[model samples]
Target chain A: MNITSYTARAPQLVQALEALAQRADNQDSASTLFHELSGITVLVAKKFTNDRTADGMHDAFHLTVGCISLGISQAGIADSNEAKLSFLLQHGAEYVFQMGFRHIKELSALPYAAYVSDFDNDAFIQQRNLKAIFLEICNADPVSVWTGDAVYQNELLDRKRNRKIIDCAKWLRKNNSNGLVKDSELDANAAISIAVIFAVSGDGCIVARTGQRELENLIARARETRPDVEVNWNDFLKKIPPEFQPILRERMEELRGTIVKKIFSKTKIKTVLTELQDHYAGSEQDIDYS
Target chain B: MSENINLPAIRQQVTELVLAGSPEHAEDAINETAEKFGDLAVVEVLNTLEPHVASLHLSAFDGGKMSLATLLIPPKAWAESLAYFAATWDEDWIEDEPEVLAESLFAHIHGVVFGTDDEERRAELLNEALATDWGTTAFAVLFSTAAEEIIEIANDIHNLGAHRSGRTTSDHDVIPLVLEIARTNEEAWDRVLFEIFPDWKPGENELHTRSEDDGDDHEDEEEREHEYAIGRTTKELLLRLRKQVPSKSSGPAKTGGRPSLGEDIFS
Candidate 1:
């Protein structure tokens, strides 16, 4: 079939998948639906490659659909077509744009004659707009888009800052050094977790402070993005051989403790550690800070 | 029918006949054996003989380019040989037998026909085979003929990693030829397309309605719109196929009026 035919056929393939997904009520059926949808996408990709007009840019659209659909299903997202569509559109759009922009470097080699002249610049314009929209929608502190060296350097700095913030937050949670901390008070780890949650959820930027209602929204968003996020420790331990489980758990605990101590030492919260040490050493009377 | 026929020795004689470039002798040996036993036993033995022959030679085309005349048998011999197998293929037996017998017969036909060594000439022979009439009791023998090869390629890709095959040319080069055969008449195209996409129907385009309960997000709405556009695009392709331009009626190039988009990287 020609590109025109493939272009016509892709939608019905997607619709058929949608119908199948809508009808699926169990895991096996949902898996089958996802498998068929993936197959259709793969076939479309194969046809796109066969198409003479495909410059790897047109391929990005189908590749995105294939990757995102596969990712959502593999990520154990809900089988409902609505949920799958929501995740795919939210995540896959940026991926498509990112892949498109990434290809521009390779595309620079092609002669002007290679361009699909009849397509004009509409596809190119749409791709450019998608990248811009991806950035706007993500509102990520350290944008992952491939820009020139200067922006990359700044992104590195931003990432370093985030790492430092996360370390401090993790320390605060472990030390519980704030004295009778309330559930309402989020430490550095919770704040960074919320930020990562928003970054993944495609919900623009993380707000400065998460109120009760805002935290609830973030939780809901996290649930949508990572439905299988929870790891059952008991079931996990049962799977691990009995002899290895205790050692593994002990090593994990030790690792956590060591990281907390290191973070506490580096952070401003080190003063709380100093106070506790001083009281233990009989150098000063206990002073309640909270 | 006698157990004293010593089928293994007979099969070896046939194998040597095919290897020695006496496919006619090999076929005669098979026929004489089939008369004693049945077509199934002869076919089973012939099935083993094909692999021996295949190992002795290469495929007809190299990197999608047709080589000069390489066929051992004449064009008439190829026609006669294919007709023999087509006539012997039992209608009721198809369901019970492994498709291997049919596959082996077609492979033998292709092996001999492609030997003519000219791509265009080989294509013509293929066209003839596709048009050949099997007896009324038999299934459309050539219905899934070309598609079966395409399915083989698909299966290979599925089993082995695509890159591991170390193929020099894309399957598209051969696909056009198969499609040409498949599209000889509307029935042929219909059968091939049905095998490829079973759920496809003429009315499916009209049956699809706009999805209700659009999610409360802008992204969902945009994706839905894109999907609608894709459906419309596929509808055009389906309509074009429905119109059915004759496939093999023309030249060997099978260009089908699609402009040369650019240099194929595979080339």
Candidate 2:
């Protein structure tokens, strides 16, 4: 829902950087320029920030790094270090506003240190995040796990699996928000139609196939959004299992529209669930699409 | 200055913070140690913390990877006057505790590869990891992302991965780079096979080498099945990789001109 505009305030920072580059011959000026550049980055970042005027400083700093990171990526096609540096020198400023604006939205996203305020370690934050996911799977209170801080060793919740669980949890959270879960509950003999499926099969024994295909679709599917890069589509398609071919092609087609210029963000996990609704449209499969 | 500061108390405090899963606080205490008592005191504290840091239980459900890595770094690092893991975190600087260091390094590498859009930096970070003493572990962890629930190894080479894992997703450029490293680095490829299949002795029959835990005495049926189900397809995939980049022990005296694993899976 947030919109971005950078047409007015980015010129001065651009001029300052251009001036610094002109004086690139001076060794003593590097430190002074470093200070000046950082100050400008923060200043320019604050100018672009919308809400969170208080944490503007933190958001500004991360926004700057994210800005530079995005620029370096946009310019990655350059063959040499000198070329990339030159590319950054000439065009990086133009990108600063756009990329910075894009990244500021993700300031509250995972892996950024700015938002993981209470936890001192990034590792702890990921654990807490995944635990949020585990709680989601059980439909338990998200804050309940930390109630006693009682530590239990769970080897199944490793990083690889945790990512899937987290993605599925995000979908479940959205479903909860959209009243989909409540809507499903209004009918008799109807189960919720989330990608997450756990059935008793009425026996203590196992009665289902592995969730790998659905899990891969639900979890790791979002990470597949690298369409900006020059990927060989056919070769990429060949690597996946045959069952997933249609879903991937459909996802790729969606990526084309959702991906912004050089930056990819619509890559977040949501599309496949919507897309797979058709793939499973009216078969004898007990899967719900309610 | 040194005599006034109690080094043991500082060590106990820092180590406890780390083991108890508060590496951020441990890092703060480490900074305070460096500030009040200076670099020599920092070294002494890390020396005390080394083996204990190695013993840090890391996983998603246990102590976090970066948190554990943040603590383990100052102790395991071969650096001089360490300000801590910054750019040099994955820059191949482990003098010892390579196994322990690799756990954290891989976490950082995954963060970069999956987090950022910079292809060049991603390759550089991963390459730095592969060049380290834990290169083989790097290769294995990348190939099969040494599950976040990294368990304590048993009768193994004190290493990573316990559960069965796979997925040849070429969604990003990182996997291609990892395969490229495995294809080219012969020594690592050999150890990579061993790293994935802890029981397989390179040239030996992989299934024969595997110790199947039938779980006859196991009370928890799920854990029993999990134990039995570990690495079934991983062993199969290792064989496929072996066919491409044959290990020195596996390739009929490891033909000198053996081809690298082709770009079929990668490109």
Candidate 3:
């Protein structure tokens, strides 16, 4: 359907939802409202899916609406009572993690490594780092919004914890003789290092210094035992082992690319790219013969 | 002095009456003929002689009720009769009432139309519809019918807005209309089902049952087997798609165009 058709139908569906919210008298009425809203949501989802060019923001907007409706349904069930509202609040938290967060993570198509990747690398990296950035921003308490205040603090701590573990795993893999560490041992080591780092730096520190120090000391200990062994974090970071790097890089790139495609594919990227080309049309750098 | 009007001419007149956008004229013609013949024999003769016209009337009546029981006439009969009508009659003879036609057809079909009654039949019909062009046609018809129901729902929603904030309408004013509409429109009912109980699976038989079992003894085993079978099928499909990916082109030269990235990003 054309945009006009969508615009025309959307109001009708929205109106139905509003009606439902107003007249919600019992569980069934609330349930009916939920069902009607869901149908509209599904229709919107299908349209977005079929559009082939719908961007991440568009998809997110649709998801947000669905999420809000779900919240409203819960509220309706609670009958606007404080006791029920408290129950709903707890339920909403669980729903956010179980359904909302999980779905966003899955739909994000973020590379496993990129989730831990430093945010300053490239434009794509910046975009891919939204979840982490959002967590950090939310934690900063820049806005006094209740949801943000509640979420940011927890997410910020969780992300830091998560990042330390990832870094520790990478460090162990780099220093290990066979480039393989026992999963349990890796987890224990990472946990210890993360705890030490958090204790030393407090919650406000952006970088985890103690974790890096512990990781370096561990590598030094491994190198001392095997004198001929080489352990270099820089080398490990800069170049993956020839045998594994290409495959791992390709996989990581694929995942990262999928996320970027999902997000920007339907946005203003086309027009932006076209404008860039036009601006550089006759420049010496525009045509790279080499 | 009745020189006996030519039978074909009479039939043609009847066809025109049926197609003239006048339900009254068509009803009158049928009633007049029945009166003239005064017997079931005449009725049978009329049906045989003007089968297309008769089917049209039948279709109209079925559409009006949105009743599947009347519409699903046997597949062989449906195909033969519809095909004959299409071949013999002009395109203009078919009415543009998509909502009516779809409701009638869907209601009549044992399985696909009314899924609650004969579930096994409904599944078979769903499978058949998905497997054939008729399925697509049926979907289009259903979608059109759904569109009208959706509008009515929108209206109800608007009325609810007016009722809120100390402007109360008697609850009874809203009950019958919404309930009746929901009852008649399968789409609305399905929406209600999905909303109230999001996790309910409609066609669990295919996903749960096995071909070999006929007894309750193997029921649990059958369910597990089918679950495994579905999981395996899903894995195979994913693996097959992965395997089909070709080696990536090295650069723009291989692509024979600038690496646009726009088209590559989405699909």
Candidate 4:
């Protein structure tokens, strides 16, 4: 089965990974094993939460098996190879490892690996030195350097808590200010903006406070400001249906009178996101918002 | 009396011609008889031929032969003859194996509705037919037929059905027929949709008239509500269809003659 199918069906695997991550620095007999497993989880999660391209998934899969093997070796497991494989398969590690192995085999134009030993020496290790592994991947495939750069850049930003959503909101606000008048462009950016806001604040309470009228006013202002160019005002206004218009309008009116902080204020953020989703939804744009 | 042609022989010949899959010849024979023996003699011949016409079992080969022959008869006489035929159309027995008879009957009604130049008379006959159970049955059969067959005369069909506006028989019954045409014939489809939803046009007076008529009749409020609901449903269906079936885009027509190869090479 595919890695995605395995991930979905096997909740135990995720729990075990999380448990290992929690005690990642423990000085017990399985300290190295725990760290290795934790390292693999972090790498895979980073690949998942950032760039979810096939290549990224393939890389995640490879690193997963490498660290899993390292963990088993460090723990001094006396089980037979077949038994070990069966245990790994049950735990959801085998799916990713198999896919990764096939991807590598196809790329190198080699026959299928008969056993774990058929894999290169670099495929297993005592511990995952993430930096060294990334550098090695870049050396083997120069195109992967960009992913390495992104990973390092995100590592710096990961230190801050609850900042990504606000940063994304600010970015969207800047984009909106720069005349998102064209229907297609407006819809795409708006969907992304809603998704970011939704991620930060659940239940859409923030948006309910901001209201529809303010967004309507914003669209009117944009159209009025640029009369020379064809800004589809009707197209923009049609984002929210007649049913939701009254309630949204009232909320926006309430938001306008308050001295609310911009991105941090849940009400203001929701107000913006709601307008964007409504507009995007009306246009039937299919970009992933969540 | 001796100079008059044999009406019985003419009737036999006309029947033979129609049964022989040659309604064109039957029409000619009837016209020749009228010209030679006068309208009275031709009428008597048709009277004598009535029994033969009644007994005709129209097969797929001769589905519309009798109707085509009826086109040769005078409109009033044709109408009277058709009335008798329709009264005797045993739907119970015919329904068992109704295809050929239904085709013939539908063709007869179609001719009456369209073959004559008189619009008022056509409307009267159509209204009469629609009011009767037999007529609605014939219409249902014809509606099913019209959907499968490509009726080139959609405009005439549209006009015939359009005459029933505000009548006891709902014009909404013709929706299936119009939609069927719309599926195959783009121009007719556009014509029908435009007729139904004239409000789509800017400054349309028809929709304004509807608004003005609203609340004028308190008793008809329920009927008006039902009609409004139907109208909404029709509009929604049409809009959905418009989304599904993209209209063919026509580019600007090129009227000029072909260009010569004598241009300044790079200019």
> In candidate 2, which residue pairs clash?
A158-B149, A159-B148
Off by over 4 Å in 4: A1-290, B1-5, B16-25, B37-44, B51-68, B72-105, B120-136, B144-267
Model no. 2, DockQ: 0.01
Q: Per-prediction DockQ scores?
A: 0.01, 0.01, 0.01, 0.00
Which is the winner by lDDT between candidate 1 and candidate 3? 1
Q: Best candidate, lDDT-wise? A: 4
TM-score of each: 0.20, 0.22, 0.21, 0.22
What proportion of the real contacts between chains A and B does each prediction keep?
0.00, 0.00, 0.00, 0.00
The residue pairs in collision within model 1 are A8-B233, A8-B234, A9-B234, A11-B231, A169-A188, A169-A189, B71-B115
- Model 4's DockQ? 0.00
Per model, state how many residue pairs clash: 7, 2, 6, 5
Residue A44 displacement in candidate 1 (angstroms): 9.1
Local accuracy of candidate 3 as per-residue lDDT tens digits, A54-146: 553355334434333233332334333343334333443223223333333333333333123334446776445544433332221111122
Q: Which runs of model 3 end up more than 4 angstroms from their true locations?
A: A1-36, A40-160, A176-180, A188-290, B1-267
lDDT of all the models against the reference? 0.38, 0.37, 0.35, 0.39
Candidate 4 TM-score, C-alpha based: 0.22
Candidate 2 error regions (>4 Å): A1-290, B1-6, B19-24, B37-44, B50-142, B145-186, B197-267
